[model samples]
Target: MSWEESYHGRLRAMAGDEEVLIMVGARCLLRDDQGRLLLIRRSDNGLWACPAGGLELGDSIRECAVREAWEETGLTPTELAPIAILSGADTVGTNQWGHTYQFHITVFLATAWTGELVTETDETTDAGWFHPDQLPSPRTANVEKSLALLAEYDRTGVFVAP
Candidate 1:
């Protein structure tokens, strides 16, 4: 099992099933050389989102972004640019075993990447490149924020509070 699963299991055993945990995660707004954004359809909810995952112990935030991008979408991030830091009350819905979480996410713009497009079927059902204006419906909050941050960065070369 993943560290997150093991940690959550231990936490649930100690604190009960309804406890809220604060998680720190990393998300990557990966883009191809053609400037198309890469989005993955989550296996759990089937909503499109940028590649992301919770950080494991001893992992740096950038390392987590690189690892999550490759794990979920098979894209090796070559360059990661800090886009924004998003923190708030975002519900991470219950797991199959009914464990819920809240997360503070660090978002990055993967400006350069390599490797063929492939989806990790266990975590993602679909992965594809889409134009910014042609994104799929029902985007995850992180994805929406990433896009907005990218737009703002492009416009002013700065990412301000939204």
Candidate 2:
């Protein structure tokens, strides 16, 4: 959906950028056979992040993740399994556009996907796969949190809630 048409975007427009809104979003994590993580360079902030977006009017959280991944990178996730619900008090931030949001993001692990990768889109300046050990600079802070959530799931063998 266009920013003007999205629920969060309309909320931001009505409430204004300075007003902090509670937002629900989702992020999808994809890995190559080599275990390299997929990352996108966001056009808005130039921050490298997983393909993610806020929930639109009719999408389930999982649908949002898949939609976002497709929108930003042209990859369609065939199967996405939720790994965590990241909604901590610290999960709040003001974007480069000065819109503050407290995010309730569902992070997903994509076990299967299809489509050719596109490096550039309206939402992203560049997209590529990277090793966790050698991530691109000026990446999103959420990258670390997403990884941590996954690690927590790994350690506990349960879905993370934080």
Candidate 3:
């Protein structure tokens, strides 16, 4: 078998009998009134992704999302109705070694939050609001999924995948 297949098989074995191979993490899609989404530049990897991070011990996913938003962009996110609950195997993620990988992600679409737009922390080297139609160059793959969830919210006043 190929290296990736073998690795996946091992992971599957490691997760034996469990439905999901990983725990839940948190993410937030913070949008401005103009339909612009806030994105962060990670200091570690320097990739532009939505202001998000993994959950800490004893922290709820929503709390993790809000905290990550603040830590990265210096913006306080107000939790709105949940936008989506995405579940799958092989959900890709990145490692500290710059290796490509996968994880299950729980994404949220928050409508209420407060904070001026400013760079405040090293967790994110830069922060900016980008129009959905004019997303920054080299956007991450998951941005499209977030945007699709937002669009679904706009169309149905709820987050139901089409």
Candidate 4:
């Protein structure tokens, strides 16, 4: 379905133009065969970010994450393990469209996926894999923190929040 016909879009249409919406979304963190993290350059914001989107009605959060990963990165994350669940007043942000949102997102680490990789998409302009210590510039504000969560997970084998 078109984004405007999706659940959040319908909800946003009902809310005031300036209202801050509480949106539930999910991020897919994928690794290439060489173990680099995957990031997408968001078309709307021109910032590098993990493939993500708001959850739709009649879909679980994991479904939302996998679906968004497929749409934005052209790969279906086959095996995902939730590594972090983040949400707070601090999570609020205004998009390029000036729509404000407080994001509740689950960050998923994918162990396997299917399909050939494609960078260009409706939501993303580019995609690439980066080593943990060598991320590209002009990335999303939360990239470091998210990576830190992943690092913690690697060291401790525990999710950031659960």
TM-score of each: 0.83, 0.95, 0.76, 0.94
Weakest lDDT window of 10 consecutive positions for candidate 1:
1-10
**lDDT string, candidate 3, 57-102, tens digits:** 5678788888778877777887555677666554755455434444
In model 2, which runs have C-alpha deviations exceeding 4 angstroms?
Answer: none
Q: Sort every candidate by TM-score, greatest first.
A: 2, 4, 1, 3
Provide the clashing-pair count of each candidate structure. 0, 0, 1, 0
| lDDT score, candidate 2 | 0.88
Error of 2 at 76 (Å): 0.6
lDDT of 1: 0.80
Distance (Å) between predicted and true CA of 128, model 1? 0.4
Pairs with backbone N, CA or C atoms under 3 Å apart (clashes), candidate 4: none
Residue 139 accuracy (lDDT) in model 1:
73
Q: Candidate 1 at residue 1, lDDT?
A: 49
Candidate 4 lowest-lDDT run of ten: 141-150
Task: Give the range of the ten consecutive residues with the poorest summed lDDT in model 2.
Answer: 145-154
- Rank order by lDDT, top first? 4, 2, 1, 3
How good is model 1 by TM-score?
0.83
Considering every candidate listed, which one attains the maximal TM-score? Answer: 2
Candidate 4 deviant stretches above 4 angstroms: none
Query: Where is model 1 more than 4 Å wrong at Cα?
Result: 1-14, 89-100, 159-162
